[model samples]
Target chain A: MSTPRTALVRLVAGREISVKLRDKGFLASTAVFIAIIVLAVVVPVMLEGDTPEYTVAATGHAGAVAEVAVELGGAEVPGLPAADITVIGLEDPTAGAGGDPVDEAFLRGADAVLSSDPDGTVVITAQENVPGDLEELIAAASSAVTAQDVAVEAGLSADQLAALTSPPQPRIDLLDPKPSLPVPPELVIVIFGFLFYFTVLTFGASIAQSVVEEKTSRVVEILVAAVPVRWLLAGKVLGNAAMALGQVVLIVGAGLVGAQAIGEGDIVAQVLGVSGWFLAFFVLGFLMLACLWAVAGSLASRIEELQSTTLYMQLAVMTPFFSAILIRDEGPARVALSYFPLTAPLMMPARVATGDAAAWEPWVAMVIVSATAVLLIGVGARLYSGSVLNTSTRTRLGGAWAAGGRA
Target chain B: MTDATLAVQGLTHDFGQRRALDDVSFEVRPGRLTGFVGANGAGKTTTMRAIVGVLRPDAGTVTFGGASMTLEVRRRIGYMPEERGLYPKMKVAEQLVYLARVLGVTKDDAQARAASLLEGLDLAERRDDLLHTLSLGNQQRVQVAAALIHEPDLLILDEPFSGLDPIAMDAMAERLRDRAAAGVPVLFSSHQLDLVERLCDDLVVIHHGRVVAAGDARALREQRAGRRYRVDVGGTDAWMPALAGMTVVGSGPEGTLVDLDESADPQALLAAAQAAGPVEHFARTVPSLAELFAEVVR
Candidate 1:
C-alpha cells in the first residue's frame, strides 16, 4: 500500500497541475511568450544585411576617374565591409548623362551612375535608400581620382600624388591590457537576469494567490482534514515547479534554436553550456521563495488581501533583479550577492555567464541556497498549518507559528 | 462495511481565555444517526473540529472504533465543516474524485464512487459543470457527495441541512440513513430541530459547551417530559378551577393543557374529568426536540 502522505501529496499536485493547465489565461499567455521567442530569433536573421557591393556605370571623361574610384572603393574601409565596385563602360561615352535614360534593369543592377557634364563637372547619382557608408566610399574614391588628376596636371611626382591622396593612419600603444567585453554576453546576462526576476515573481505570486483562494473558499479545511499540511505545501511547490521548469525549457530551447538559425549559435552555446547551473539555481531559488509564498498566502483570508500580504515576497524577488542590473559591473557587490541565497539565484548564473566568478563560487552558492530552502520549507510549513484552517481574518505569522506548534 | 463508533470524552478546548468547549462528551453508536443539536456559539463547531483533528483540544480525546483517532483512522472518517468548502473552479465530479483520492482511494475507484454519488444525489447531469456554476442547493448536494465519496467508516457533517431545500433535505437525510444502515456511525450538527427530531435515531443536545442531554431521541423526550397533561372533555371549563394541584397553563378548542404537581395523581384527575362530562382525551404531552432544547438551554 502506498503511504497515505505521499499519495495525498501526489493527488494535490496532480489537481494543481491539471487545473492550471486547463486555465485559458495560462494557455494564452504561454502561447504569446513562445511567439515572442520565435520572433526574437527570426527577426535578426531577416534583418542581417549581406556583404556590401556596388556597381557603377561611367561615361566619357569620367571613365578614368571611375576606374580609379572603383579600385579604391573596392578596398576595405576601416570599420565597414569591403565594397566590390564594377565599372560598366558606356558605348556612347555620355550614355549615362544625356544619351538616353538608363533602363530599369540597369538601374536595378547598378548601385550608382557616374557621368561628366560637358563643362567637366563629375556627377554621381545613387540609388534610393543607399546607406551612408556606401555613399562615403564612393565619394572617397571619386576624390582620390580627382586629386590624382590635379596632381598630374601640376606636374607632381608619383610619390607626392600618392601621399596627397592617402589619408594618414594613427597608431597608439596602451599601457594596460583590458579584456574584451563582447556585446552578446552582456546582452545575454541582462536578459537572463530579467528572466529570473520575472519568472520568480510571477510564479511566486501565483503560488500565494492559489493558497489564498483555497483559504477563502474554505476548501483548505477539507484538504487539511484529508492530508497533512506539509504534504499539501510540498504538492503545491512541486506542481508549480514542474510548470516553471517547463516554461524555462521552452524559452531556452527556442532561444537556442533561434540563435543557431541566425548564425549566433556560438553565443547561445556558451549560454547553454552554463544553463545547467542556471537550472539548478532556478529550482532551488524558486523553491525557497515558493515556500514563503505559501506562507504569505496562508496569512491572507481573501484574494483582495493577498496582494498586500505577499508584497514583501514580491519586493524580495525584485531586489535581486534591480541589484543585478544596477550593480552588474561592481565586482564586490556581485560577489557578495552570489553568496546570499536571496540574490544568489539571479546573480550567480549571470556571473558565471560573464566569466566574472571563480569556478567554485556557483557551487558554494547552490549549497547555501539549497540549505536555506530546506529551512524555509520547515518554517513555511508551520505557518501554513497554523493559519490554513483559520478563515476568520488575517492570521499573523507569529500566531500561526504558535498555532502550528500546538498542533 | 466496518461498524465504527465515535466517542468524544471530556473534550475541552479554549480560544485564548475564552472557553469554546468545556467537558463536552457524546457518543455516536454504530448504525445510528446522531443529531448534534446546539445553539449558535454553543461549541458545536468546536466539538466537530476536535473530532476531525482540525483543532487540538486542551483536554480529553476522540476515539474511533475503540482506538484513539490516528491519521490512519482519520483517513477512514469523512468530515464536512460548518463552512462548506469546495473548489469553485473544479468540476463537480473531478473535485469529488480528487478528495477521495487524497484519502487513499484508487483513482478508478474514486471516479466510479464519485459518479455513483452524483447519481444518487440527482446531480449526474451537472457533474461536468464547475461547482460555482451550480445553484446553492445543487452545490450543497455536491458538498454532500464530496463527503461520501470515499465511503468513510464514520461520517461527521456540520450543519449539512442548513442551506438545503426540503427536497434536498429529504435526499440528504435518506442518504445519511442509508450510510447508517450500512453500519457507519453518522454524527451531524444542525439547528433544525424538527428535521433532527424526524431523522436522528439518537440526539446529543449541547448547551454552554456541555452535553446537557444525550441518548435515544424518544428517550430524551420522555426523560425531559414534565408532569403536564392535556385533557379534553365535552363540557365546561369550570371543573379546571376546582383542581387543587393542577394549574391551567393553556386552553384551546381541542383541550386544556394542565401543569400538575408531581404529587398530583393523574388518574384522579382523569376520573374527575370523566364525571364532569364524557372524557374525549387524556394524555401527557411529550416535549418536542425544540421544546427540549429550549428547556435545557434556558
Candidate 2:
C-alpha cells in the first residue's frame, strides 16, 4: 500500500513536469521576459560609448554659451536650430518700439519658450518650463558673466578680468562613491530584488490558477476522493516546486553559461549561486502562497473571483520591491521585510545580493518560512476539502468544517 | 445476499438554514445498477459527493461494504463528478494515466489500463492530442474513460449522460451494464427516464432532497398496480369528478389518462365514461416511469 502511494506521488510529479514543458506559449514567453531583463542590464554595460546625451534648449547669450559648450564636446539637443536665438535679437513686437521678439513667438509655437529682456535679464516664458538640468546650466552661465562684469568695474586689465572668468576646472570625480549614486552592490541588489518579486509573482500566480482550474473543472473532487487532501495538496506544491525550480535553473544556468562564454567574470555565477538560496526561500515561499491561493480558489465559486483574491497575494509579493525603493538594502525597513515570510521570498534575495543578509540569517529565515508553509498547508487543505465542493452562496469556515462533523 | 456495496443511513446535510439532504437513506447491492433520479437541486450530486468524501454530510454516514467510506474505501470507488474537469493543457493519455495512478494503481498498470480504455472508448487515435484540441464530445468521452481507468469495485456517476450523443449514451449504458454484470455495484443519476427504466435493476427517486420512492424497477411498477385508464371521449375533464374513487393524472388531444383506486374497477370506469360522452378509445395500462415520476413527486 505504501509503495503504491509513493508511486502515486511520483506519478503526479511527473505529470506536472511534463505538462509545464508542453505548454509552449507560457514557457517561451516566460523565457523571453527573463531574457529581456538580462539584456536590459547587459546591453547598457556592454555599450562602448560615452554616457547618454542630455538635451539643452536656450537662446541669445544663453544660446552662445550652449554652442560653445557643444564645441567643447557637449551634444546639441537635436531638431531645433539657432533661428530662435537669431530672432531673439529682434525687437519685441508687443512693445510700441517695434522690438518683435521672434524668440518668444517661436517659444509660443514651440512646446517650450526662452526669451531675454532689454535690461540684460533673461526671462523664460513658455507653455511649460524646461527641465531643471538645462535651467541649472543657464543659471551657472549667467552668474559667470555677472562676475566678469564686476571684475571689469574694478579697473583691472581685460586679461585680468578674463583671469577672473577663467573656466572652473572643478576636477570633479565621476567615480565618486557617493551616498546617492548606485554602487555595484546596489545594482546587484536591485536585479535580484526584481527577480525575487517577479518570480514569486509569476510562479505563485501559476499555482493559484492551476488550483482554481482543478476545482472549477471538478478534478480536485476525484483527486480528493482517491487520496487524503494532505497528499493531494502536498503533491501539487512539491510537483510545481520542482517545475518552477527547473525553469529557474534553465534561465539562471543559461545566464551563467553566457557570462562565462563572454569572459564576463564570475559575477553571474555568484548571482546564480545566490539564486539557489533564493530558490530555497522561493519553494517554501511558494508553498505558503500556493496554499493561500488554493484556499482563495476554494472560497470563490467562479473563476472571475480569482483576480480579486490574488490581488492581496500580488501585493505581498510586491512589498519587497516597494520597500527597496524607499530604503537602503540593509535598512531596517527592508531587513524587517526579509524576516517576514510573506515578503521574505523577495526581500532576502535583495539582501543577499547586497551583502546585507548574514550567511546564517537567510537559512534561519528559510526554516521559519518552511515551517509556516507546512502549517498553512494544513489549514488550507482542511478549508479546501470542506468547501471546495459546496456551491452554496456561503461556505463560511465555521460551517464548512462542521458540515462533515455531524456525519 | 450479496454484499451491500454502498449504504447510506439517514444522511442529512444542511446549508445554513436550508437542508440539502434530509433523512436520505438507501442501499446499493453488488451486481445491481441503482438509478438515482431527481430534478435539478434535488441533491443527487450532493449525495454522490458526500459518499466519496468530497463533501462531508452534516449527519449520518455512508459505508462501502459495511465499512465506513474512509480514504481507503474511496480509493476503491470510481467516481465521475457532474462538473466535467480535465487539464486542458495535458494530453489525453497522460491525464488518464495520471488519474489512475493517483488512485494507487502502479505506473505500469495505470498506463496499460489507460491505453485499453482509450481504445475501448474510440479515443486511441487522439491519445497524444491535448485535451483542449479535442472536440467537446470527445473530451467528455475522455472524462468517462478517466473515471473507469482504475476499474474500482464501485462506481458513482452524476449526470453521466448530459453531454453524450445517443451513440455515446448507449455505449455508456452498455459499459454500466457490463460493470454490473461483473459484480461491481454501479449507481448513477440521469434525467433520461427511458434509459433508467431499461438499464436500472432498482430505482431511487428523490424529490426536494428527500427519497419519495425507491425499490426494484419492475417491483416498483408492480407496486403501482392501481389501474390507469385512457378513455378517448369528449368532456373527459367534466366527467372526471363524477367518477367514484378516480383521479385525473393527465389529458391530451388523444384522451384523458385517469388512475382508478384499487377498489374501483377499470370496467366500471370505462362504462361510466362512455355513458357520459361518445368514447373513441378505451384501454387500461400501466403508467410509464415518466408519468410515475410526475405522479410521485406531485
Give the winner by lDDT. Answer: 1
RMSD after CA superposition, every candidate? 3.7, 11.9
lDDT of 1: 0.83
Q: After superposition, how far is residue A310 of candidate 2 from its true place, in Å?
A: 0.5
Cα deviation of B138, candidate 1, in Å: 1.2
* TM-score of model 2 vs. true structure: 0.70
Once superposed on the true structure, which residue ranges of model 1 sit more than 4 Å away at CA? A52-55, A60-78, A82-87, A93-109, A116-122, A127-130, A140-183, B1-3, B235-249, B259-265
- Residue range A6-112, candidate 2, lDDT tens digits: 56666666766676676786688668966875675466557732332434445665555444433333333342221212112323466634544545454434333
Evaluated with TM-score, which candidate comes out highest? Answer: 1
Q: Each predicted model: what fraction of the native A–B Cα contacts (within 8 Å) does it retain?
A: 0.75, 0.79
Candidate 2: lDDT over CA atoms? 0.73
Clashing pairs in 2: A91-A99, A91-A100, A92-A99, A92-A100, A93-A99, A93-A100
CA lDDT of A69 in candidate 2?
A: 34
What is the lDDT of every predicted structure here?
0.83, 0.73
